[model samples]
Target: MSVTDRPVPSHDRIARAAFPRRRVLQAGLAAAAGAAVLQTTAPAEAAMRREGWIRSRIARMSVEQQVGQLFVMRVYGNDATASDNRNMNEYGVASPAEIVAKYHLGGVIYFAWADNLPTPAAGARLSNGLQRAALAAPGKVAVPLTISTDQETGIVARMPDPATVFPGAMALGAGRDPELTHDTYEITGAELRAVGVNNDYAPLGDVNVNPANPVIGVRSFSADPALVAELLVAGVNGLQSQQVSATAKHFPGHGDTDVDSHTGFPVIHHTREEWETIDAPPFRAAVEAGIDAIMTAHINVPALDPSGDPATLSKPIITDILRGELGFTGVVVTDSLGMAGVREKYGDAEVAIRAVEAGVDQLLNTPAADVQYNAVLDAVRSGRISRRRLDESLVRILGMKYDRGLHRDPFVDESAVDEIVGNATHKARAQEIADQTITLLRDDADLVPLPAGEVLVTGYGDTTTVNLAASLSDHGHPAQAFVTGSSPSQTLINSAVTRSAAAAVTVVLTYGADTNTAQQQLVQALRDAGRKVVVVAVRNPYDIAGLGDTPTYLATYSWLSVSTEALAKVLAGEIPAAGRLPVSIPSQADPDTELFGFGAGMDN
Candidate 1:
């Protein structure tokens, strides 16, 4: 039976009743009698070969429905009554299926927590629910949506329960091997897809040009352009291997800026040549390697696009440099419009209108989705944004969806997910990568694998060196651990100096960051004690500048559990340290190491 002749399903009636805004708009999208609007045409970029049912359905959508596919709206996770109750209570956009149909939402980007799904059986159940929501569309296939999430490891933990947490970008950066980076992303992508996630906005390609930068911190892989590029390639290949598209982010460059774009405009002060040589290399490499998506940052690059608008809506940057100069043909997407960098400057509709005019293909986390839609429609009506441009972007977006076979029967295989979700092979890969990436900066006198010594451990932040100290103690060595939330307190320093005076060794883990006021003080503290100081950088490799030559130095580059275990193994001489410095270490006097040469290494 034809779709119209078939009785209206309960879901259609409910969605139509709940979202009159959508029903009235899409009532005319069908080819049947009583249709109020233009019938759907073949999806702008609908898969050229797939004859799947969903593909056929997408091919039938009208222009408006095709345009709808460019949007990716955020949704809170549900399926568990407790989760549903909590997230739904916080955000009103509950009942994802109805919301999908009502809003004409192309896809649902769920902010999820899966820590509760401990067993394979439990994970499959939840993955199925999310997949159902992703495939939900009232009476249409041209309206097929793309589900996405920020699964960038430690930077943003999705599920603290049910899922294993891998050390994030910083940890991978410390390992300094593209292959390890590859395995890291592969594992992350596999787990995400197994849980029904289709897009991972990850593998942050920023060069991290500033050490004091609060947010990016160790999140960046390295300061070296070449290393970052190779890592980006590995990350892309790994994610795509699992069919989870990874997005390389912060287009022009977000590394040099010290300001957090989420709260303010981050100014990238490098010249055109500087950007091309360093900050832009990784992104360029990712694009060349056929990365599926590119997300623009909200930061301002004065030299590249001085129009004062964020790259998200800047034509010169997105169209002129990104599309024109760089030769990137992939989808050009915008970061969240809700971020302060964009919202503080442009109104929601205006932001949406400009992004399209600037050649953006997808809109992520737009606050007023309908407002942006209406504004784009108005621009089309006013001849402000050319219909050709709109169609062009829509075609690119649709083409990707079609390639993914989203046009026909887009649901993920629920039963098959259990086998792939947190698979043993993936975890083993992570462990192997971790084993190879840990760096031993200064292993003087082969002092490591110490026969026996009373060791005193201290560092920045709240995370104590209790674990490291315990790891040392198991070898029949006496050890003590002390921790503070802030950078080393005066009392902690005094206590550490006194304790070190009588100890065989002192191992300090700095939890705060690379550039700090403690560099000079740390050196003085160790000199006063005349102790063998072993400083392990748990944040950024460049942070080791604080240690000087006072004692031994090691940079784990991240505080993730894997890297920690790796460091423990290195101290125990379980594996030879093979990780080279992915980025340069700043000179002892220069605490900010913005430019570090890649492949800097030393043996244990």
Candidate 2:
């Protein structure tokens, strides 16, 4: 689907289109009605105009309280340790529940640690804990609390024990499968909503314009801007279908840089015309499709704002372009206040104040609550920014809270969260995607089937690959799987070379893009041992730049254990290799070159 496939229609038209797609029967205010509501509802009294006592009971607040509705800072649970405290201090708060209660804060984004006892039933329990805390203190009126989470596939996921993972967005785009994209994201959203996650900052619409981009490499849908726009729209629509709010993020683009925007500032140099042409397409498509939110990029776009600050602080980009030109009247959010792109340069208090000045509806991952809150209060008192602007942002945030039905009721079914999270269906669907997206980019020697002799398998030490090895016992071969990572005094490549001599074909597998040293060691080991190394380029192909003399090679651009097992079957000749490279896997020394284009592969 091209950008022109659907002209940027009005929000009413988009809502009409989206209503049929949604299972909910909720009627929303039209633009005119919303504008009228904004005009008639006073800053201190919008909560009282026409709402019922139950909704008005807790949903309305003063202008100051309304502005407070726009900041969704990161939070930690009660069991946080020293490291957790340090991490939170960098950008989040120590006790989020208390902050929400006192400040009447809008929402909390959970960046829960890897081993924080994730369970399907935990989502609601955690949400209820936060909600109860947030509602402890009544506002001048009353307002509900909002909770959100980042459950992107394979990265920062929070699926409970029984849950499975689908291929990330890039794999779906690489496979050129829209049905798969729609189905996978829909399942993901269902799983999230079942457990009480209302907002999902996903379907990374940013095109992977830069292959070396540290953050967005495999998270993006495709390198082609057009395809990213198309598949991303489908992905967002799929998520929205499940009643979960889908958000397009890293606005103005994040896929064209090698540096990590989280730790450093990277600049995009697209011209104004190019912005209209390239970077803005995905976001514009989402808004036209009635997407709930758009998250600002931390990276600087020189053309959008020459001030060198990220788009999060630039009015020309956020207000003038995003709000004015693009006609996105929905919530506009910042990525995270603590990200180095903005934080290393701006003050905590100033970050919150400037973001609002830029017309943002939500301040993500706030730095210091005390500093940020005081700065906003100072800005309001000093007349630097208006009560109207604050109220304007707050109204949208309140609308979202109302839409979430928090205003009508400020509680989650804490007891119900466990039943819905990480259940059988969720895991099965994740496994299905894991199996489906597992591709076969290379199989040059057709030396699969293992010949029933010595077999060698290896990949990341993480949970996925370890599970693959455990599952591979069914293949009827003597298999040895090694862990891949940067090790002390020893490397994965060195270990692979040493072990390759004893195996028939070193069926090497790797997950995640950063595990390169292990892959290199495997290639070198294969060459030195004179073994048939049927290499599998999992995840980002950018990792395996040099594979020495390995005649047999495969690309299964994923690390899911199910996919890894499927690849093992392909190697064992149980199934024909039907997958191909969604992205090019370049050779060694030619780190700048691509061996094959997207969709390049061999099959039966």
User: Judged by lDDT, which candidate is best?
Assistant: 1
TM-score of 1: 0.81
Off by over 4 Å in 2: 1-60, 78-96, 114-117, 408-410, 462-465, 487-495, 511-518, 548-550, 573-580, 584-593
Residue range 1-604, candidate 2, lDDT tens digits: 0011122234344345444552433356586577566566674374553234434533456545665677786655533222346435544545555556555677878665723335665556666666666666653455656567666665446665655566677667645656677777788787776656678888787877666678887788767666667667777888877767788887878877877978998888778787767677777777777777888888888888898888888899989988888888878888878789888667788888888899898988776776787678779878887877876776666666665556556554656555555557766665555554545544456565556577666545556546555565676666777666433125556666677668776666644323455456555556666777666666675554555445556655566655677666666666755544445555545656776565565553
Candidate lDDT scores, in order, read: 0.67, 0.66
* Model 1: per-residue Cα lDDT over 480-519, one tens digit each: 7766434566776777687778778777777553456554
Count clashing residue pairs in model 1.
15
Query: What lDDT score is found at residue 402 in candidate 1?
Result: 57
lDDT value for candidate 2?
A: 0.66
